[model samples]
Target chain A: MGFAIDKIRADFPILLRQVHNKPLIYFDNAATSQKPQQVIDALVHYYTYQNANIHRGVHALSQEATDAYERARDLVKTFFNARLREEIIFTAGTTHSINLVAHGFRSWLQPKDEIIVGQAEHHSNIVPWQMACALTGAVLKVLPIDENGQLQLETLKSLLGPQTKLVVVNHVSNALGTINPIETIIEMAHGHGVQVLVDGAQASSHISVDVQALDVDYYITSAHKMCGPTGVGMLYGKKELLEALPPYQGGGEMIKEVYFEGTTYAGLPHKFEAGTPNIAGGIGFGAAIEYLNTIGLEEIAAYEHELLMHATQGLKQIEGLKIYGDITHKTAVVSFNIGQLHPYDVGTLLDRMGIAVRTGQHCTQPVMDFYGIPGTVRASFAFYNTKEEIDIMIKGVQRAVNMLQ
Target chain B: MIIEAQQEIIEEFALFDDWMDKYEHLIGLGKTLPLIDPQFKTDQYIIKGCQSKVWLRAEQQDGRVYFWADSDAIITKGIVSVLIRAFSGLSAQDIVNAPTDFIKEIGLNDHLSPTRANGLVSMIKQMKLYATAFAAQNNA
Candidate 1:
C-alpha cells in the first residue's frame, strides 16, 4: 500500500498537540517513537478487560490472559522470523535483554577469554559486557570505527582470536545512525567459531529483521523505539543456547519443581523470565507490530530515506556545520553541530521553537571521545514526520546558529 | 538579601517582547562576565554537568567573597553571569543566606533552574560551597 503520510500523522495523538505555543515537530524517534492510537487502545483494553495472572490460574480470566500473552510471543517470533516459539523471551527492554545474556555467560567464560564489541555501541551494550568481563576475568576488546563512523571490519578480523568467545555489536549506532553491516559481521564472527549477539534496538523500528536469515546467534530489541509500549521487549535466542544458559532470575513461574535441597529450572523462555512480566505492554507490542505491518516496512523505509536526504542537503548548506556518521548507509538521523556553539545551546533553542531533539553524548561517550567533541544535536525522523517538518528544523538550526554566533 | 541585583535582571528581561531578544541579551551578558583566570580553568575548579562544563573560582577579598566563572556553552555562561552578579561581592554569611528565588523570577526557570541537571544548578551549589569554606576560614 502507498504511504498516506497525512492520515498516518493523524494516528498519533501527540502530533496534534503544541509545545511552547508552536505546533509540535517530533524528531526524537530514535529515543522513542510516539505511540499510535491502536497501541494506546491496546493497553487500555488489556487493563480494562484481560487483567489476570498467566500460566497458573484456571479461571476464564486467567485462561484469556494467558492466551493473549502467548499470542503476543507468537507474534514476536514471527515478526523477527525466529524458528521456535520458546526462543522468544520477554524482558524489560534492550538493556535488560543484554544483561540477561551477559549474566548467563558468567560461568561459560573463563579467565583470559574475550568479548569483542563495536566502538560505536551505546553505554548499555558496552557496560554490561564490561561487568561480565570483570566478573569472569575475561578481556573486553573494542573493534574500532573509522573517522566516518564505519566500523573497520579488518580490525574485526584481527579481534576475533582463539580466545574470543562472542562478538557483540549493534545493528545500528544510536548516536550517529550508522547502520553497521551486521549480516557481514555475523558471517565473519561465525567463521572464527564465535557466537554473535546483535543489538537490534535501533534497527527493529526502521527495518524488518530476520534472525534466521541473518543466522544470528542472538538478537534483541526494545518495543518503545517502534511505537510500542515501554518496559517490555523480546529477545530471540536459539533454543539450544537458551536451554544451555542458566536462568537470569529465579521466581515462581521459572521453576520446574522446588525442594529445600535442590530445585529444577523450567525450560527455554520461562527459564530466563522469572516472576510476572509486563502483560499489557507485551500485548501492546503485538498490536504495534500489527500496526507496522499495515504501514509496510518497505514504504516506511523509502519515505524516511527521502526525508533524511532532504534534511542532509539542507543542513549541509549551513557554514561550519559538521554532521557525524556515514549518512549514506545509516538510518534517518542527523547529528550535527554548528561552529563554536555547544549542542545544548542549539537544542534548547530548537525546543523553544516547538521542536523536540536530543542533545549531549547520547550515552555513547566512546564515539564522542573519538570525535573529540562534547556532543552533537541529534534529530531523528520517523514515518510520521513530514518534509515540512524537516524544512522547519533546517530553518530552526540556521536561526539557532545566528543567535549563538 | 540580594534582591536589588535580581530585580534589575527581571526588569531588563521584561523589556524584551519575545524569548529571542531575551536570549540575545543573555548572550551579551555572557560576553560581559568577568573571565576566570586561565590557571583555574583546569579540572580543579571544574564543576562537570551532564550537558556542559563550568569552571568556578572564589576568593575572599577583605571581608567580602568574590566569584569568577566560565562555561563552554555561551547560554550557560550567561545564566552563570547573572547568578554571579547576584551573589558576588557579598559577605560570606550574606552569600550563604542569599535565596536563589531570583533565578526563577528572571524567567530562566525552565532551562537554567536550580533543579535542572544543566550544570547551572551545580554552579549555584559550588558558589555557596566557596562561601561556606570562607566562612569556616574566618571562624578558624
Candidate 2:
C-alpha cells in the first residue's frame, strides 16, 4: 500500500478548507468519515443518470436502478463475506439495523431470556436491547469492562448460560476504541445455543469484517461511519436466522401477495426492506466501500493505530491533562479532559483554532458513569489524518488548560 | 433601559415562542457578556459535568429573574442561547413550572444530539435552581 497521505487528503474536498482562519484539521472521523471524491461522484452519477425505483419496475430505467441497488448489496456481501446476498438487508443506518433485530428477533426471545451486552457499547446498542428486554420481560445482563476500558471476556463468558438467548456486542467500542474479541464471543455464545449480533458501526471502516469467519448470527453497520452517505446501512444475518425473524416493518415491496384474508411476504432481504429505500444512498455506499478497499483497510488501520499511539505519547507531555480511555490495542479515538477545565471548554478553544473534535459522553453514558465524569473531549482519527493535525490538537488543548489555570 | 421597555420585555415571557425567536437580541440587551473574563477559569466555578466552559450568571430585576451564560464552545453557546430564550424574563415560579417539552417542540434538540441534550438539560437545571432562589427571596 502506498500510504499516500497527501493524495488521500486531496481526495476529500472538505479537508482543504479552513475553519476559524486556520486550515481544517478534522479529528471527528468516529462521528462520520469524510467522503472521498469518488463516493460523492457516485452519488451524483446515481441521481443524474440512473435514478428510478428499484426491485419491481419493468422499464429500462427500472432495470438499471435495480442493477445498481443489487450491485451495492453484492459488494456488501463480499465486503463482509456474508453467506448470501439475500441475507443482506438495507437499513437507514446502524441504529435502525440494530432496532430491527432487537424488535424482530422476538422469535426465540422467551420470558426471562438472558441478553448480554458490554458496558462500553454505544447507547444505540445498549438502549434498544434494554428497552427490548424490558418489554419482553427478559433479563438485560451487562459484561463489565476493566479500568483500561477493555471488556472482561471471562466475566462475559461466565454471564452467558442456558438462559442466554441473544448476545449483543460491539465489534469496536466507539468511545474507547477497544477492538473486542468478537470471534471468541461468537464461538462461546453459540456453544450455549445463543445468537450473537455485532454492532460493527465503528469497526467496519477500520477493520475487515467476515461474518462467515466470525460466525455471528447478525451484523449491523452504518454507511456514514465509513464515508458513505447517511441514512444507509446494512444488516447481515445468517440466511436461516433472517428467514425465521419477522419483518420489522410492513409496507410496499416486501410482499409477494397481500389480501384481506392474509399476506404472503417476500423472501429474505426484501422481507425486511419495506417501502422505497435510499437508492442513491445505497449506490453511494458501494462507492464508499470501493474507495476504502482501494486504500486498503489494513493499511489505514495500521497508520491510524500508529497515529493514536504517537498522539497519546505527545499529549502526555502536556500538564494538567487527564486522558480518558487510555487502553493499549485501541483504535484512533483519544478522549481526555484538562484539570479544572471542562471538556466543553477544552473543545471550544480547540474549535477556535479550526480543530474539530467531538466532546462529551460520545453517547456512551455508561462509560462516563464508570469514570465518574460527565464527559470528555474526544479526538477521533481516520486514514487521511496526519501527525501534524494531532500536534495542533495537542497545542490547542494545552493552551486551553493554561488559560483556564 | 426605561421601566416601560423593561415591562414590555417582561410581558414577552408569557409568549414563549416569541421570546425564543428574539432571545439573541435580548442578550444583546445586556452589557455584552463581558468578554467572558478569562480570570473566571479557576476550579471554583468549573462545572464538573459539562464538556464545554459554561459560566452562568443569574440576575434579578423587579421581582423577575434573568440568566446570562457564555460558553467557549459554539454549539454550547447555541445551547445557552436556547436556555436564555426559555428561561429569561420569567419569574422563578414560571421557570420551575415550565416543562422541558417546550425544548422538544422548538426542535432545538434536533440540531443537538442526545448527549448534547443531556448537557442542555444540566444547564437548564442549573438555571432553574438560581431561579428558585430568586423566587424564594421574593416569596419571603
Candidate 3:
C-alpha cells in the first residue's frame, strides 16, 4: 500500500489554512483528529438528505435514517473485526462507553472483587471505576508504570489474582502515548478469569483494532477520535459478556414491550441504544469509516511511524529538552519539556507561532504526578502531517527554548 | 487613577507589533514584579483555575488596598504584575469600580483568553473580592 502524503493532506480542508500569519501545524491528533472533507460531506449529506429518528417509524425518511444508522453500526462492527453485528453498541464517546460497562459491572462486582486500572489512565477512565467501586464494595487497584511510561508487566502479573474481576487499560496512553501491553494484560487477566476493557480512544484513528484477535472482552472508542463525529462512539463486548451485562440506559427503542405491570427489554444493540440518538452522527461515522478504508489503516500506520521517527529525531536535537514516554513503544506523540521551563510556557510560545500542541497534564494527572512535574507539552501527529512540518516544529521548539532560556 | 494606570499599561503594550515582541516585554516585566510577601506565598492564597501556581493576596492600608501576586509561570507572573499596576493602591470603592477594558486593549489572550491557562480574570476578581470584603468591614 502506497502512503500518498500530498493526496492525504488534500483530503483535509483545515490543512490548507494559516494560523497567526503562519501555516497551521496541528500536533493535537490525540486530542482530536482533523476532519477530512469526506467526513464533513457525510455529516452534511446526513443532515441534508436523511433527517429522522432511527429504529422506529415506517415512513420513507425514517427507513432511510434507520438504514444509515444501522449501516454505521455495520461499519463499526467490521472496522473492529467483531464476530457479530449486535456486539457493537453505540454510546456518546469512550467515556460514556466505559461508564456503561462499569455501571453494568456494579451488579456483578462483589464486595471483595478487585478491579485493576492502569496508572497512566486518564481521570475519565479512572473516575467511572471509582464510582462503581464506591457503589459496590469492590476494591480498585493500580497497575504501575516505569520511567519510560511503560506499564510494569511484572506488576500487572502480581496484581492479577482470582479476586481480580476486570482489568482496565488504554490501547494507547493519551498523556505519554505509550502503546500499552494490552495483549499480555488481557491474556494474564483471562488466566485468572478476569475480563479486560481496552480504551481505544487514542488508538482507533492511527491504527486498526481487531477485537476478536485481541480476544478483548470489552473495547470502547469514540468516533470523533477517528474522523467520525463527536458524541458518537462504539462499545464491543463478547457475545456472552454483553448478553450477561444489562442495558445501560432505559428509554424508547430499547424495549421489546412495555406495560404497567411489567416491561421487557429489546435484545443486543438496541438494548443499549435508547432515546433519539445522534442519527446524523451515526451516518457521519459510517462515512468516516468508509473514508478511512480507502486510504488503508496499514498505510496510515506506516506513514505515521515515519513522521514519529522524524519528529523524535528532530526534537532530540534541542539541548536541555527532556522527553517523557517510551520512544520505541509509543505512537506518534512527543511529550517533552525544555530545561526547567514549565510546559505551559513552552506551549504558549508554540501556540503564538501557529504550532498547535497540547499542554498541561493532557487530562492524565496521575502520569504527571508519577513523573513529578506539573505537565509536559505534547505534540501528536497523524498521517496527513509531513516531514517539512516536523522540521518547522523542531525549529519552532529551538526558538521557543532560546526565548525562554 | 486606576483608569490612568490601565492606560499607562496599555500604552506600554501598544509599542509591540507582534505577539513575540509583546511576550518578550511581558517576560521582562515578569522579572520586575515586586515579590509577594514571603508569608502570603503559601497555597492558601493560590488561585484555583490556572495551570501554573498563582498566589494572590491583598491588604488594605488606611483607605487604599495594595495587591500582591506571584506565579511560577513567567507570563502569568507578568500578567498579575500588569493587573496589580492597574488596580493596586486604590480605595476599596475605586478598586471595585475600575473598568477592565484595558485587558482587551493590551491583548494578553495567551493568559486572558478563554483557555484560562493563567487566571488573570480570576486574579482581578480576587482583588475586587478583597476590596469588597474590606469595604464591607471598614466601610471605605
Candidate 4:
C-alpha cells in the first residue's frame, strides 16, 4: 500500500503556518521534526489532567501519572526493540544521553585504553568521549570518511586492538546525511570485544531501530527529531552493560538508599534518571511513537527515499550547485553549496521566500573541515514533506542564486 | 553625519518593496565594504558569539577611529558593512555614543534571524569596545 502523504501532512498543524506571507515549507527536519497534533494533544492532556509527580506519591493522580509515564517507557522500549524495559533511560536529549554513558564509562576505562569515534559524528558524540578519555587517561582515535563520505571501515578495523575499549559513531550524519553501515561496524567491533555506541539521533526518526537485532552495546536518540516534544530523549543499553556501569547522576530518583555514608543507587533506568523528569515530554514521545507506528517506519523510509531522490534531481539541475554526501545511502537531507555563494546568504534569501532551510556547520565542524568549507545550505525532509515542497525549494534556491551571484 | 548615514540607510531600505531587494542591497553594500587586512583576521581581532567568523580591525588616526571588518558569511559581511559605515571615520567618543536604534529603524533587526541578530549585537559591541580602547589610549 502507498503511504498517505496528505493525511500525514494534515496531522502536523505547523504545516499550515505561513512564513513571510508564503506557505511554510519546513526542510529543517534534521534539526527538529514538527510535532503531530496527536503528540501535541498528548502533552496538553498530560498538563490538563494527568499533571502530577510520579513514583513517589500515593495519591490517585500520582498513580495515574506514574502509569502513564511507565507506559511511555514501555512504548520506547518496544519502539527500539530493547531486551528489557529497565534498559531504556529517559534523558534530556541526545547530548545528555551520550554524556550519561560517557560519564558512566569514565571509571570503567583505564589508562592507555583507546576509544574510536567517527569524523562525521556530531559534536555531542565526539566531545563527551574526548572528556571521558581525558578523565580516564584513555586515548582517543578517529575513523575517517572517504571522499564519498562513507566511513573508512578498513581504517577502523586497523584502529581496533586489545587497547580499544569502545567505538562511537552516528547511525546517520546530520551534516552530510550519510547513513552509516552501523550494523557491520557493530558486528566488527564485537569481534574485537569492543563496546559500540550508536548515536541514533538522526536515524531513529527515519529508520527502524532494533537494538536486539543490532546487538549494539548502547543506542541513543532524541525524541524531538522524531516528532516528539523537545528536551526529552532515550538511551537503550544492554541490560548487563547498564547494570555494570556506575550511575550517571546522584539524585532522588536515581537512589536506592541515602545516608551520611555512601548511598546505594537505584537499579537500571532510574540509576541514570536523576531528578523530576519531563513527564509531559515522555508521554508526548510515546504519542509520537504511536503516530509513527500507525504510518509505519518502513513506509516512511520508502516515501522519504523517493522524496530524497526527487530533491537530489531537482537540486542538481541548478548550475554551480554541489551536493555533499553519498546519495546511495542517505536520508532525506541535501546539503549543498552554489558556485562561490555563502550558505548563509542562500539560507537568508530562502527565508525571505518563506523556505526554512538550515545553514551552518550543523554542529559537525570536523565534517565541515573535511569538506574544506564553512558550511552548506541543508534542506532536510520528513515523511510529511512533499515533492511539491522540494520543487518550491529548488525554485527558491535558483532565485537566491540569481540574486546573490 | 553618523546619524545622517543611518538615516540614509533607512531611506535606502525603504526604497525596496520586499526583503529580497533589501538583501540584494545589503549584499551590494557588503561587496563594497572596506575589508580588513588578512593579518587582522586572527583570533585576537575576531568577535565571538557570531555564527559566522567576523574579524574587525580598528585604527585611530588624528583623534578619529576607522573600522574595517570582514565575515565568512555574505549576510554577516553585509551586516558588518552597515555597522562600519555608521561608525567609521568618527571620533572615538562619537562612535562609542552612537545610537544602535537605527538598525531597528531600518527594519534590519526584523529581517534578521535570531542568530544573525545576536551577531549584529556582537559586531556593534566589538566596535564600541574598539572605540573605548582608542579613547583610553588618547587619554593616556
Error of 3 at A161 (Å): 1.4
Candidate 1: regions farther than 4 A off:
B112-117
Candidate 1: global Cα-lDDT? 0.91
Interface root-mean-square deviation for each candidate?
Answer: 0.6, 8.3, 0.9, 1.4
Candidate 2: which stretches are off by over 4 Å? B2-140
Local accuracy by lDDT, each model: 0.91, 0.81, 0.88, 0.91
Q: Report clash pairs, candidate 1.
A: none
Query: Per-residue lDDT of A1-405 in model 3, one digit per residue for the tens?
Result: 467888889999998888888889999999998889998998888888988877778999999999988998999999999999999998998999999999998999889889999999988899999999999989999999899999999988888988999999999999988998788888999999889999999999877889999999999999888888888998999989988898889999889999989889988988888888888888888988998899888888888888898988889888988889946777899999887888888888888898999989999999999999999999999888999999998998898887777
User: In CAPRI terms, where does candidate 4 land?
Assistant: medium
Model 3 Cα lDDT, one tens digit per residue, B4-95: 89889999999999888898888888887777888988989988888888898888898889887788787778788888888889999998
| Model 4 Cα shift for residue A5 (angstroms) | 1.7
Clashes of 3: 0
Error of 1 at A159 (Å): 1.4
* Residue A198 lDDT in candidate 1: 93
Candidate 3, after superposition: displacement of residue A145 in Å?
A: 0.3
Relative to the unseen true structure, what is the C-alpha lDDT of residue A307 in candidate 4, on a scale of 0 to 100? 95
> Over the true interface residues, superposed, what is the Cα RMSD of model 3?
0.9
Error of 1 at B33 (Å): 1.4
How close is each model in CA RMSD to the real structure?
1.2, 7.9, 1.3, 1.4
Question: In candidate 1, residue A150 scores what lDDT?
Answer: 94
Arrange candidates by TM-score, descending. 1, 3, 4, 2
